[model samples]
Target: MVQVKVFDCEHEKDLEESMNKFLQKIDEKNILDIKYNVAAMVELDEDEQIYCFSAMILYRK
Candidate 1:
Protein backbone atom coordinates (compact mmCIF):
# COMPACT_ATOMS: atom_id res chain seq x y z
CA MET A 1 0.00 0.00 0.00
CA VAL A 2 1.21 3.46 -0.89
CA GLN A 3 0.07 6.70 0.69
CA VAL A 4 -0.21 9.90 -1.30
CA LYS A 5 -0.50 13.38 0.10
CA VAL A 6 -1.32 16.51 -1.89
CA PHE A 7 -0.84 19.94 -0.41
CA ASP A 8 -1.67 23.55 -1.19
CA CYS A 9 -4.88 23.12 -3.10
CA GLU A 10 -6.91 26.17 -4.02
CA HIS A 11 -10.31 24.59 -3.70
CA GLU A 12 -12.06 21.38 -2.84
CA LYS A 13 -13.13 20.83 -6.41
CA ASP A 14 -9.60 21.33 -7.57
CA LEU A 15 -8.36 18.75 -5.12
CA GLU A 16 -11.00 16.27 -6.20
CA GLU A 17 -10.19 16.80 -9.85
CA SER A 18 -6.50 16.49 -9.19
CA MET A 19 -7.01 13.28 -7.27
CA ASN A 20 -9.06 11.86 -10.13
CA LYS A 21 -6.40 12.84 -12.61
CA PHE A 22 -3.76 11.22 -10.45
CA LEU A 23 -5.81 8.05 -10.28
CA GLN A 24 -6.07 7.95 -14.03
CA LYS A 25 -2.41 8.64 -14.42
CA ILE A 26 -1.46 5.90 -12.02
CA ASP A 27 -3.82 3.46 -13.71
CA GLU A 28 -2.35 4.26 -17.08
CA LYS A 29 1.14 3.83 -15.71
CA ASN A 30 0.14 0.38 -14.38
CA ILE A 31 1.37 1.02 -10.89
CA LEU A 32 0.67 -2.37 -9.38
CA ASP A 33 -3.11 -2.18 -9.33
CA ILE A 34 -3.46 1.09 -7.52
CA LYS A 35 -6.60 2.13 -5.71
CA TYR A 36 -7.77 5.67 -4.87
CA ASN A 37 -9.30 6.64 -1.55
CA VAL A 38 -9.60 10.01 0.16
CA ALA A 39 -8.37 9.91 3.73
CA ALA A 40 -8.46 13.49 4.99
CA MET A 41 -8.72 17.12 3.89
CA VAL A 42 -8.33 20.52 5.45
CA GLU A 43 -8.87 24.08 4.33
CA LEU A 44 -6.66 26.80 5.67
CA ASP A 45 -7.78 30.37 6.30
CA GLU A 46 -10.70 32.25 4.75
CA ASP A 47 -9.22 32.63 1.28
CA GLU A 48 -8.75 28.86 1.14
CA GLN A 49 -5.34 29.40 -0.33
CA ILE A 50 -3.91 26.39 1.42
CA TYR A 51 -5.28 22.87 1.52
CA CYS A 52 -4.07 19.48 2.69
CA PHE A 53 -5.10 16.08 1.41
CA SER A 54 -4.34 12.50 2.25
CA ALA A 55 -5.12 9.43 0.25
CA MET A 56 -4.53 5.71 0.42
CA ILE A 57 -3.51 3.58 -2.52
CA LEU A 58 -3.43 -0.18 -2.38
CA TYR A 59 -1.21 -1.90 -4.85
CA ARG A 60 -1.10 -5.63 -5.44
CA LYS A 61 2.12 -7.27 -6.37
Candidate 2:
Protein backbone atom coordinates (compact mmCIF):
# COMPACT_ATOMS: atom_id res chain seq x y z
CA MET A 1 0.00 0.00 0.00
CA VAL A 2 1.15 3.48 -0.82
CA GLN A 3 -0.07 6.95 0.03
CA VAL A 4 0.54 10.19 -1.82
CA LYS A 5 -0.07 13.82 -0.96
CA VAL A 6 0.20 16.60 -3.54
CA PHE A 7 0.23 20.35 -3.17
CA ASP A 8 -0.52 22.91 -5.84
CA CYS A 9 0.56 26.50 -6.17
CA GLU A 10 -2.83 27.58 -7.48
CA HIS A 11 -5.98 28.65 -5.69
CA GLU A 12 -8.07 26.12 -3.82
CA LYS A 13 -10.83 25.94 -6.40
CA ASP A 14 -8.33 25.84 -9.21
CA LEU A 15 -6.34 23.21 -7.44
CA GLU A 16 -9.43 21.05 -7.01
CA GLU A 17 -10.27 21.28 -10.68
CA SER A 18 -6.68 20.81 -11.70
CA MET A 19 -6.33 17.80 -9.46
CA ASN A 20 -9.41 16.23 -11.04
CA LYS A 21 -8.04 16.82 -14.49
CA PHE A 22 -4.66 15.44 -13.55
CA LEU A 23 -6.25 12.44 -11.89
CA GLN A 24 -7.85 11.69 -15.22
CA LYS A 25 -4.49 12.00 -16.82
CA ILE A 26 -3.08 9.57 -14.32
CA ASP A 27 -5.85 7.14 -15.17
CA GLU A 28 -4.99 7.43 -18.81
CA LYS A 29 -1.31 7.12 -17.99
CA ASN A 30 -2.01 3.87 -16.11
CA ILE A 31 -0.11 5.06 -13.08
CA LEU A 32 -2.48 3.56 -10.57
CA ASP A 33 -3.04 -0.19 -10.59
CA ILE A 34 -4.53 -1.64 -7.45
CA LYS A 35 -7.71 -2.91 -5.83
CA TYR A 36 -7.40 -1.27 -2.43
CA ASN A 37 -7.31 2.50 -2.23
CA VAL A 38 -8.54 5.75 -0.78
CA ALA A 39 -8.15 9.23 -2.26
CA ALA A 40 -9.25 12.61 -1.01
CA MET A 41 -8.52 16.31 -1.47
CA VAL A 42 -9.11 19.26 0.84
CA GLU A 43 -8.76 22.99 0.77
CA LEU A 44 -7.25 24.19 4.00
CA ASP A 45 -7.46 27.82 3.13
CA GLU A 46 -9.43 30.15 0.85
CA ASP A 47 -8.77 33.78 1.51
CA GLU A 48 -8.09 36.24 -1.26
CA GLN A 49 -7.07 38.52 1.57
CA ILE A 50 -4.04 36.24 1.87
CA TYR A 51 -1.47 35.56 -0.83
CA CYS A 52 -1.20 31.80 -0.51
CA PHE A 53 -3.28 28.65 -0.61
CA SER A 54 -3.13 25.58 1.61
CA ALA A 55 -4.35 22.30 0.15
CA MET A 56 -4.00 18.68 1.08
CA ILE A 57 -4.40 15.37 -0.71
CA LEU A 58 -4.73 12.02 0.98
CA TYR A 59 -4.35 8.74 -0.86
CA ARG A 60 -3.89 5.14 0.13
CA LYS A 61 -3.24 1.83 -1.64
Candidate 3:
Protein backbone atom coordinates (compact mmCIF):
# COMPACT_ATOMS: atom_id res chain seq x y z
CA MET A 1 0.00 0.00 0.00
CA VAL A 2 1.13 3.55 -0.70
CA GLN A 3 0.73 6.26 1.91
CA VAL A 4 0.57 9.95 1.12
CA LYS A 5 0.93 13.02 3.34
CA VAL A 6 1.42 16.78 3.32
CA PHE A 7 4.05 18.68 5.26
CA ASP A 8 4.47 22.39 5.89
CA CYS A 9 6.79 24.50 7.96
CA GLU A 10 7.86 28.09 8.68
CA HIS A 11 11.55 28.28 9.39
CA GLU A 12 14.44 30.70 9.04
CA LYS A 13 16.91 27.90 8.47
CA ASP A 14 16.89 24.69 6.45
CA LEU A 15 13.49 23.30 5.48
CA GLU A 16 14.85 19.78 5.24
CA GLU A 17 14.54 19.38 9.02
CA SER A 18 10.79 19.74 8.98
CA MET A 19 10.52 17.53 5.92
CA ASN A 20 12.41 14.73 7.61
CA LYS A 21 10.28 14.93 10.73
CA PHE A 22 7.09 15.02 8.72
CA LEU A 23 8.10 11.94 6.78
CA GLN A 24 8.81 10.06 9.99
CA LYS A 25 5.41 10.92 11.39
CA ILE A 26 3.79 9.23 8.42
CA ASP A 27 6.27 6.33 8.63
CA GLU A 28 7.62 7.27 5.21
CA LYS A 29 10.77 5.24 4.87
CA ASN A 30 10.85 5.55 1.09
CA ILE A 31 9.52 8.57 -0.70
CA LEU A 32 8.16 8.16 -4.21
CA ASP A 33 7.48 11.75 -5.32
CA ILE A 34 6.88 15.28 -4.07
CA LYS A 35 4.20 17.64 -5.30
CA TYR A 36 4.22 21.19 -4.07
CA ASN A 37 0.91 22.90 -3.43
CA VAL A 38 -0.16 26.26 -4.83
CA ALA A 39 -0.81 27.54 -1.35
CA ALA A 40 2.93 27.78 -0.80
CA MET A 41 4.16 30.95 0.90
CA VAL A 42 7.25 32.92 1.83
CA GLU A 43 8.28 35.29 4.61
CA LEU A 44 11.18 37.65 5.02
CA ASP A 45 12.94 38.36 8.27
CA GLU A 46 12.66 42.04 9.06
CA ASP A 47 16.08 42.28 10.64
CA GLU A 48 18.16 40.21 8.25
CA GLN A 49 15.99 40.36 5.16
CA ILE A 50 16.30 36.58 4.98
CA TYR A 51 13.50 34.79 3.18
CA CYS A 52 11.80 31.53 4.00
CA PHE A 53 9.45 29.70 1.68
CA SER A 54 6.54 27.75 3.07
CA ALA A 55 6.68 24.08 2.13
CA MET A 56 3.74 21.99 1.02
CA ILE A 57 5.72 18.80 0.53
CA LEU A 58 3.33 16.10 -0.70
CA TYR A 59 4.80 12.66 -1.06
CA ARG A 60 4.10 8.92 -1.06
CA LYS A 61 6.23 6.55 0.92
Q: Considering summed lDDT, which 10 consecutive residues are worst modelled in model 3?
A: 37-46
Candidate 1: tens digits of C-alpha lDDT, residues 1-61:
4545343354567767776776665654445443333444445555443344444444322
- Arrange candidates by lDDT, descending: 3, 1, 2
User: Candidates' TM-scores?
Assistant: 0.36, 0.36, 0.37
Rank by TM-score (best first) = 3, 2, 1
Give the lDDT of residue 3 in candidate 2.
55
Candidate 2 residue 16 C-alpha distance from true site, Å: 1.7
* Model 1 worst lDDT window (10 residues): 32-41
| Most accurate candidate by TM-score | 3
Tens digits of per-residue lDDT, candidate 2, 18-60, equal 6676566443433443222233455568532433444444444
Backbone clashes in model 2, listed as residue pairs: none
Give the C-alpha lDDT of model 3: 0.53
Q: 50, model 1: CA deviation in Å?
A: 7.3
**1-61 per-residue lDDT for model 3 (tens digits):** 5665555444524466766667676645556677653343334553443334455544444
What's the lDDT of the predicted structure labeled candidate 2?
0.48
